[model samples]
Target: MQLVLEKRAERSGTIALVSPLLAIGLTIVTMVILFAILGKNPLLALHAYFIAPLTDGYSLQEIAVKATPLVMIAIGLSLCYLANAWNIGAEGQFLIGAVAGSWIAVRTQGTDAGAWVLPAMLVLAAAAGALYALIPAICKVKFGASEILTSLMLVYVADLFLDYLVRGPWRDPHGFNFPTTAEFDPVATVPLLIEGGRLHLGSIIALLVVAAAAILLARTIKGFEIRVVGAAPRAARFGGFNANQLIILTFAVSGALAGLAGIIEVAGPVGHLQPGISPGYGFTAIIVAFLGRLNPVGILIAGLFLALTFIGGEQAQIAMKIPLDVTKVFQGILLFYVLACDSLILYRFKLVSSNRQVPRGAG
Candidate 1:
């Protein structure tokens, strides 16, 4: 017996659309099994994980807050992915942005830096992220390096660097020796959308990013170049597109977005530049990008959905004694199923029977 996967003559749009949903369903099933194995009521756990988070105003607000960074980062990632440029170091870019933006905030601390401070921080963060991202892109273009390895490795470097800053130079001297910077001044902070509410300008910015991405992908020549280069590199090259240039462009864009997201996270919810500012938003955006099928509007929806998981994970940990690591496990499984299902978009599995050799000699 033999099994094979044969490429289809045409890609299945249906499967492409359905794959993420299938992955989500499979992940839920797996979670139920996991709950059962842990001696917890699967139904109750499921309720906590999915239903409980939506039942209150506070949880809803938190979900939106969490989704902001996810949506923003995923939008940039989608652009890079569309151009066949793998920018896996978005986590590093995110950290670098936070650091760069915080530099301004730290300097302006206790000084009347005016409203320009926040805008300046955001711009610096975005620029810093772009520069950080270009490192891997340039290396790939100039030295034939694998971006996947370089980008991912840089994440730890960024993490360690951030750790050093908070524990060393940027440390709040009066913060009881904690490894964190002083809280950002009002001028450096992102304004809240509602007084005393979690909703902030960052959420609005995230929405704008989604809208802009949707327009760019739907109605721009550069967007067409990205799609063409990714889908058919040979054709794109024949049409005078430079793949290396596209790689650099997409990486820089993705990095800038990631950086913007990082600073918003610090200036908005975190209120300071700290070591643990991100709950892996940079990494989680990869799931958002794929779950949304690399579509801008789709990414917005996917970001909200994944944001639910973050809240649900917290609720589950408190209500059911479930470990927080389970959320990471769920995400990993979901990503696996998503990639697996995507295979069906371009190929189908077939089982073939092999004739017995003895049949030719005796039968």
Candidate 2:
């Protein structure tokens, strides 16, 4: 007998909505087993992973701070996925954005630059990200290159470029050889939302992005085209939708959001450009996008949920001596189960006879 996954005639709407929750359940079960094997109390570990982080004001604000970039980046990724454009280089785009924006901050440091500096940095970062993302899109359109491969490959290029900049030209002379640019000027910084609090303007911007994305996907002709292109290419062609154009458009938009997130992270939370400005936020946002099922509102929720894991992981490391990498493992497991559960929802396994008479002239 041979087993195969056959597409369901019609997916259950209820199952579709429940798939993410089920995936989370499965991931938690897996983590419990892992904790037991690690000689930790599974129940206590679970509490540390989920409950402890939400019990304090500071941790709540930190979650929001971390969620800001995740939501922004994931929203962009959702657009790419909805348009059937595979952009796997958002990390590269994020780094490149941070680098582009920091160019303004670095140049204007200690200068009497006015309020325009921050806005200019954001605009430049977004533009640079969009342009960088277009490279893979254009290559895919003109040369038939695989976007997944080209985009993923570009990440390394961006990483190395940023590393070179920080360690070479942009290094802060007074930072005791640290590979970083100097702190951004007040004019170039993201404003705090509350005095002496972790929350900043970036979180507000992230929420604005979520709202705008919701509007774009729910109320616009372009949104209709993206859905059509991804769901039914033949129908899209009949409807006069250009698949190539949509791919380029989605990638550009995706890159632009990633760039904006990068700049916000640097100017808001991080206060400077550096080699590790992102702790894999671009890569992690992919998980958030999928976990949220590619919806804007869902992405916001998923981003916050994942942000909790980051905080919980740190607390686990300090309180329980749990390895920090366990958080990555949890995320990886969650993503794996998410895909598996989604597959089960959209498909069914069938067993059939392997041997069959071949048609005449069939090889």
Candidate 3:
């Protein structure tokens, strides 16, 4: 007996739309089992994870703040994925952006830099991110190196570089020996949407990014090229689209967006660059990208849902003594289910039996 997945003649659009929801449902069921195994009340844990975070105004605001970066980074990642450019190092690009932006912030810590300061930081961060992402793109184009491995490996390098900067030269001299820079000046900070509230301009920027991405994918020739290159590369080439150029372009754009997200997180929320500025936002954006079906609008909704989990994880830890790692487990399970469910869109499983002659040695 043998089992195999057979390709379908046509992909089911219905399944494509429902796949993410199916994955979410499966993830929830798995979480319930996990909670039971951990000796916790499954219903209560579920309530805390989903309902509790939504009921509070403060938690709702915090969720928006968290989603800002996720949506921004995911939007960029969606482009890369669409163009068949595997960029696994958004985390590194993020760190590099924060570090690059902070250079301006650090230098002007106590000085009177003009309004141009914040804009310069943003531009520099985006540029740095693009340049950093180009390393893998160029390597893949020129040397036939795998972008996935090179990009992922560079993440550690960027991480270590950021760590060294904060612990060494970027550290605040007057303050105690903490691995952080001085608080950014007001001119460098992102303006808040509401007085004394966590909501900031970054959220608005994320919304704009979503809208822009929607337009790009739907209305632009470049967008069509990216889609063709990813979906049918040989055909795209026949149509006069250069795959290598698209790869470079997508990587640069993705890196720029991720870098923008990084600087926004530091300037808008943290007010300083530190070691743990990101609580894995770059990595979590991967889930956001897929869960949204790589659509801008979908990514927005998905980002908010994932942001709720971050808040829920904190509440679960504080109220139920649940391990924070459970949230990560939930994400991992969700991703697995997502990939598994998506296979059903284009494939079906079959069981087959071979003739006895195949096992003549046993006879």
Candidate 4:
């Protein structure tokens, strides 16, 4: 029994080191099979999905576009996960932030708010997101509510609220009955970092946030407390770590980053508030955070990789005549392998003898 337990511990450690690589490998293999089932050459599909995106500047830019919000949201999520706080309402926070930021942008039209307008909108977005996140945080702290359910349910509420606004009060009168707001003025737009590239300043902000989060998690007292709180709540409490404060702080930070991502998305690539502005970046970032093992730097790279999948999916649809749902399948497969690999990281499989040992046991 002791030997078996020792072996299992070693196996778990080994799996922790190899799980990420295994997940990636499995994702690739699954995609190959999917392409074959679709009656397309797997090689050609692979090229379209992976290699083709890197062969040109435009496609690379699109990858950045998709990765920007993902990185931002995932960075915040890393913090929440570290504190062992489950904040599943990033989607709602994102939507609310977009709404708030766009409201400021639209209201400031015909005025010379200049550079301050964009900054103000961003601030509003962050605040809106944080406030939205506080609802669940407060409930959890005061009433012992399950944050997962509350946060997730709020996402639908935020989505419906946005839908109502765009279709009702905030509808563009000149949009030909479209469910979108007016085009944002230039003052409300997020500036591009490169003159000829689709990459925007938001990418720079994301990198900065990543660096900041890493530093916070690695070098700060608060970071130590967060780790302690997650690793051993009883010890953390004994050490005087305030659980309520950590919970609120974690949610606030997560919501703020998500809000920032939402507004930047609308002001940058999106350029207007639409009924469905996000392509589920909020939800996808949860996967990114976990796939990265909840590490800030890891989340950054994982976000880029997932962004590649999105770009590749679009390319596969256009070039290979594959359905868009294929991309979702790829994501689903990736998630499955990631979770399976994670399980192996903490558990070991044992093969037991099927045959009865009656003679050996003297039964």
Model 3: per-residue Cα lDDT over 1-363, one tens digit each: 888899989998999999999999999999999999999999999999999999988899999999999999999999999888999899999999999999999998888778999999999999999999999999999999999999999899999999999999999886599899988999999999889988999999999999999999999999999999999999998999999999899999989999999999999999998899998888999999988988899999999999999999999999999999999899889888988999999998888774435534664
> Any idea what lDDT model 3 has?
0.93
- The lDDT per prediction is 0.94, 0.94, 0.93, 0.88
How well does each candidate superpose onto the true structure, as a TM-score?
0.96, 0.95, 0.96, 0.93
Question: Poorest 10 consecutive residues of model 4 by lDDT?
Answer: 1-10
lDDT of 2 by residue, 71-159 (tens): 99999999999989999899999999999999999999999989999999999999999998999999999999999999999999999
Candidate ordering by lDDT (highest first): 2, 1, 3, 4
lDDT of 1 by residue, 1-363 (tens): 888899999999999888889999999999999999989999999999999999998899999999999999999999999999899889999999999999999999999779999999999999999999999999999999999999999999999999999999999999999999999999999999889889999999999999999988899988999999999999999999999999999999899999999999999999998888998999999999998999998999999999999999999999999999988988888888888999999999988776646545564
Candidate 3: stretches off by over 4 Å: 1-3, 351-363
Q: Once all C-alphas are superposed, what RMSD does model 1 give against the true structure?
A: 2.8
Error of 4 at 361 (Å): 22
**Number of the candidate with higher TM-score, 3 or 4:** 3
By lDDT, the better pick of 1 and 4 is 1
RMSD (CA, Å), each prediction: 2.8, 2.1, 2.1, 3.5
Superposed by TM-score, candidate 1 places the C-alpha of residue 333 at a distance from the truth, in angstroms, of 0.6
TM-score for model 2?
Answer: 0.95
Candidate 4 residues 122-189, lDDT tens each? Answer: 99999999999999999999999999999999999999998998898888889999999888889899
- Residue pairs with backbone overlap in model 3: none
